[model samples]
Target: MPEKYHISTTPVPPRLPRIGKYGIVDWREDCARCHNCVKKACVYDRHRQESAYLRTLKYSNFLFFECMGCFYCVQNCTKELLALTINSEYENLGNQYWTPEIIQTTWQQAETASVPVSGAGYRGKFAGRGFDAMWTDMSEIVRPTRDGIHGREYISTSVDIGRKPAHLEFKEGRIVSETPEILDIPIPLILDMNPPEFTLPRLEPFILEAVRMTDIIAIVDSTKWPECLNEKQRQRMDAYLPNIAFHLNSEAPEIPKDVLRKTRMVEIPDSDDALDRRAALREAVPGIVVSIRVPLNKRGVDRAVALVDQGADVIHGVADFNGNEINVKNPRFIKDMIREIHTRLINSGARDQVTLIAGGGIALPEHMAKALLCGADVVSSYLPFMIALECRLCSDCKPGLSCPAGLEAIGFDYGVGRMRNLIAAWYLQLIELMGAMGMREARRLRGDVGRAMFFEQMEEEIFGTLFGTRKQA
Candidate 1:
């Protein structure tokens, strides 16, 4: 058996004060001044740490809100002087979709390469919008031995990206069919290009290094080409070509034949001449896997099916950065879009012939698993990596504007380490999720809705007949 995949991670502390969810407001005037005060009983030592933080505080108004909100101190206080208050800073961290909780959790994962555990149990609603509307079945969690991450059983998270042959053809004594080349990555996650606002000259190197460390592929725009890399980087690019995928558009300059030959995969935007481009790329690099990138709009599903029928090797359905369908007011979520595409391809009897990659709004490790369950063979994410590097997701990221969080000043080592830690954390979480679902292979998890429950489906089954269709607001 091949060696098991592992990610080496070390704790990378945050650059700024942590924006945690809850803060303790101590009413010292009502304190009894007891030597054995409830504040002293803090298991996490948050009170002592808060005092230390205040002594050397860089910003006087910046309050320490790292309290875990366990309520042990609040309930134990003799005079009811201690109370937990929601941190305003935390509530304002991210937009509605990328909530403050999500940002903080991603930060913790990036720093420690471990699952985020609130000392207090889940304090959120049972179901909400987006990915929360779907839940993976964890009935198998009762079996402790099924733990893939730390148990004796090995749950494979590896997936192949390329055209798969439906069946083998043979002559009397030998095989007579040609086999397409496939790229296999240990984890079903790929690093996507950063959005225009966050794009920086130094960012590419950091992304390439992280991709190299994780042994996975990154999607790079071909138009940028060799200009994006320095001479040294260009020379070393050949070695990492297998881990790189070039994204090509009609206007992009032609890639050198030698460079194309070294790369295992290339993605072309969906167009009328996409098949012609795919053919040209294959003619240049005979074994190259060509993936068609289609926007997850109304036509996405039909377009994906057409490309598959035309002998496309892979189909990538991409949504907006926030995971919503583009150009529509009532946009469908990426999950629903993926499910539609997967089902359509299956109905067309071409699902197994091509690889499906879903991108955009893949913020968490759980999101990766959920995307797969929705029918994507793998997922791509770029924003999480930025978050890993302490990016505050400021609205204005122009060159002239001063960066609120000083992201441009980040050292390469620190940035790369944090990104690597985030990937490691995500990989561990994926393994844990697969184990709980009783799935031994990540590939099998694709389109396996039987192992998951959709809120809309349940609502229709239980409440539809009596109440009719639920009205959308």
Candidate 2:
């Protein structure tokens, strides 16, 4: 007989309920009283004695305590029974891409504010979209007894979002600054906005303040003002503008002739003569960054190359806020798009000079790490804010103030705190994820590119040539 997984050897977490009406329901319907009673013949004999449990009306015994839902009984049962079913608990982790397992895992960590465990031992599908298609490199498990967090041998998964100079010279035998190209962030997460989903002025301001206080820039579109707010709220926007970075007015960009700008960077839609246009844009407004917005798609590589050639200070590649790829055909997906652009930039020797800001498809905290493997310096997101606000993904915010998530009328302080807590939780989880991946510093992770494993590539490596053909030489 073939070996069994998820049972006999691995133990169920005691935190879960041991026995209840919820239990034994499956066993009674599926049990067969064969001589072996194959259901009783567990590999470890973990099944309880048939006579020890309460007998049921159906003439089948109920051994509620011993069944692990491992499907071992189902496999061996002559009655052809045993199945797993939903228990009517929390269903959504949000969005089709994020999946219940990932959200459940992250939320479990956030709710307890602690590390997670593989208690069920990976009860999900192996292949899917975005970061789900790639995995982190954890082959070398250097168990350091002395220092668990800062082990002797580890992987660094942190990243930075600025440029680096080629070479530096100590002018007077002292540390005179060379070219300061790179601005290193301690963590790889960035704060971005979906203003249509969040209408609170106070909430946005507080979120910006918190992020800027941590030296993390918040990406907001400032044109969402209702024109009905009091003067103080309007002023708050101006005050925060200079402090938090902005992704302003990409659809119909309007940089004033005098460039009355407060933002450190601006990510506009991709335009022709992008390089010369950026030079002119910078000339119009000094000390302001010029970024080009790239769609997160399979064509990410081509778009990135064009943007870089045009001299974009940054490339803000955004997938749909719900984490879907733009193109249906040849959907290389967002995680791979980031990696494709990163590798393209690295191969061109320009990775150190430009920032890659990837948003969209960033559903989980660990998506930040997955983004890093694809060579992004920073990752930004939105739906996490909705999830933070207890958004059930009913998708109602698009038509004016009819949001089903209740964001249209959400209280300022409560909504803001919830958003802050979500970001804060993500921050802690980011640290834990980076630490687990064997990384200590965040800046060294910029375009690190090797932090994850691509299952597609792995599949090709394992069976592509055996069953399929490689491109002709």
TM-scores for the candidates: 0.94, 0.69
lDDT of all predictions, in order shown? Answer: 0.85, 0.57
Model 2 local distance difference test score: 0.57
Q: Candidate 1 has which clashing residue pairs, if any?
A: none
Tens digits of per-residue lDDT for model 1 on 239-312?
67777899985788888888888888899989999999889888878988888899888787778878888788
Please provide, for model 2 over 318-376, each residue's C-alpha lDDT reduced to its tens digit, 9 standing for 90 to 100: 87765556765545567767777888787888777788888887877778777766777
The top-ranked prediction according to TM-score is 1
lDDT assessment of candidate 1? 0.85
